[model samples]
Target: MEEILQLLSEDARLTDAQIAERTGISEAEAKDAVAKLEKDKVIRRYKTVIDWERAGIEHVFGFIEVRCAPERGVGFDAVAERIMEFPEVHSLYLMSGAYDFLVVIQGGNMRDVAYFVAEKLAPLDHVVGTATHFVLRRYKVDGDVMVERAQAKRLPVTP
Candidate 1:
């Protein structure tokens, strides 16, 4: 099961037959395992990591450190759900240390992100404070390298 998951994680496009062949298991068994994983919500939706720069999409990304007072009984879950409802919030995580949540958001520009932070995020009930850090560049994301470092061009040394 672990091997099947590992293979799928590496390449989501692999068919059940391919996975079974790779793991030396029967196709039916592989299919059953995969179906069980999906049914149990162990296998989330498959995702495609895109290089937005290559796609020529102009956008700004920001990581917002949010400090909020947790709601009684519900804790951070309630606040998290409210924050997640916004389309600009790509990802939200309940974090440790000084911040309560680490929110990843995207917008057209700095102003758009700032507006979202000021008008949308900051005004939310129980939201005490926030620190927004704009992403200047992305070297890598989700285990995929976004940018390739250039090789140095130099003459060969001879003795």
Candidate 2:
């Protein structure tokens, strides 16, 4: 089961036969396992990572460190649920250290991201403060290197 999960995580495009062959299991068994995993909500969704720079699409990614007051009894759950409803919020995590929540957002430009922090996220109930950082470039994402290595160029030697 773990092997199947690992295989699927590495490459979502793998067929049941491919996974079964690699794991030394029957193809039908692999299919059953995957079906069970989906039913149990273990396998959330398959994803594709794209290079927006190469695609010529402009987007700004922002990481916001949020300081907030946790609600009584519910703690951060209530606040997290509220933040999740925003379309601009790509991801939100309850964090430790100086901040209570780390919010990842995407927008067309820096001003768009700034506006979300200043108007939407920061003004939320229980939200005390927020510090935003823009991602200049992504060298790696999800263990996959974003930058492709270039071939070394050598100058011609004079005889």
Candidate 3:
């Protein structure tokens, strides 16, 4: 299962037959394992990490460090649910540091993200303060390089 998970994690496009070939398992077993994983809620969603900039799609990302006051019974889960409900929120995490929640937001522009933080996020019931960092450029995302690295040209060899 771990082997199947690792392979799927690296490349979600891998078919059961491919997984079987790599993991030295029978195709039927591989299919059953993958099916069980999905049914068990282990494999949640398959995603494609796209280079949106190269695709000519203009967008902006903001990393927001949110300071919050947790609800007595729920801790941060209550506020987390609210924050995650927003369409702009790409990802959210409960952190252990100066900030309580680390929120990643994607928007059409810097102003749009700023509007979301200032107008929407800051006004939330338990939210105390926020520090937002706008992404200038994306070198890599999800372990995949966004830009192609320049290859070194070989010098002419004389015999």
Candidate 4:
């Protein structure tokens, strides 16, 4: 299972036959293992990581640190749910600090981002205030270079 998972993590697009061939398992066993992993919620999702900026997204992406009221009982989760519903929000996390949540958002310009904050996020019930800082640049992403290097290494097997 660990070997199968390693192969999938390196590239989830591998066929059962390929996985089995690499992992030294029968093709049918590879299929069953993948199915069971999905059923057991071990493999929750397979997602594509896109370079949105290179894909012609011109504006800056920013992280907003929000201070919200804990009186809402569910704390930041309720507010986060509302925030995530917006298309502009790429990601949100409940943080442990002076701020309750960290939100990642993207927009075409500063004006668009401002509007999203003022019109949508700020209006949420427990939200107190928000501090936003735009990302100037990204040196690395999702450890792509590391993954590419790992992929380049030949799998150890007697084929």
The candidate scoring highest on TM-score is 2
At residue 97, candidate 2 shows an lDDT of: 90
lDDT of 2 by residue, 105-152 (tens): 875888888888888989998999999999999999788898999979
Please report, in order, the local distance difference test score of every candidate based on alpha carbons.
0.91, 0.90, 0.92, 0.82
- Candidate 3 residue spans exceeding 4 A from truth: 151-159
**What overall lDDT, based on C-alpha atoms, would model 3 receive against the true structure?**
0.92
| 1-159 per-residue lDDT for model 1 (tens digits) | 899889888899999999999999999999999999999999988987777778888788899999999889999999999999999999999988988999999757788889999999999999999999989899878777788888898779867
Clashing pairs in 2: none
Model 3: pairs clashing at backbone N, Cα or C within 3 Å: none
Which portions of model 2 miss their true places by more than 4 Å? 150-159
**Candidate 4 wrongly placed segments (more than 4 Å):** 106-110, 146-159
User: Could you list the CA RMSD of all candidates, in the order they appear?
Assistant: 4.8, 5.1, 3.3, 5.0
Candidate 3 per-residue C-alpha lDDT over 1-159 given as tens digits, one digit per residue, 9 for 90 to 100: 998999999999999999999999999999999999999999998998877788888789889999999999999999999999999999999999889999998758888888898899999999999999989999888888888899898879967
For each candidate in turn, the TM-score is 0.84, 0.88, 0.87, 0.77
Answer with 3 or 4, whichever has the higher lDDT: 3
Better of 2 and 4 by TM-score: 2
Two-way TM-score contest, 1 vs 4, winner? 1
Clash pairs, model 4 backbone: none
Ranked candidates, highest lDDT first: 3, 1, 2, 4
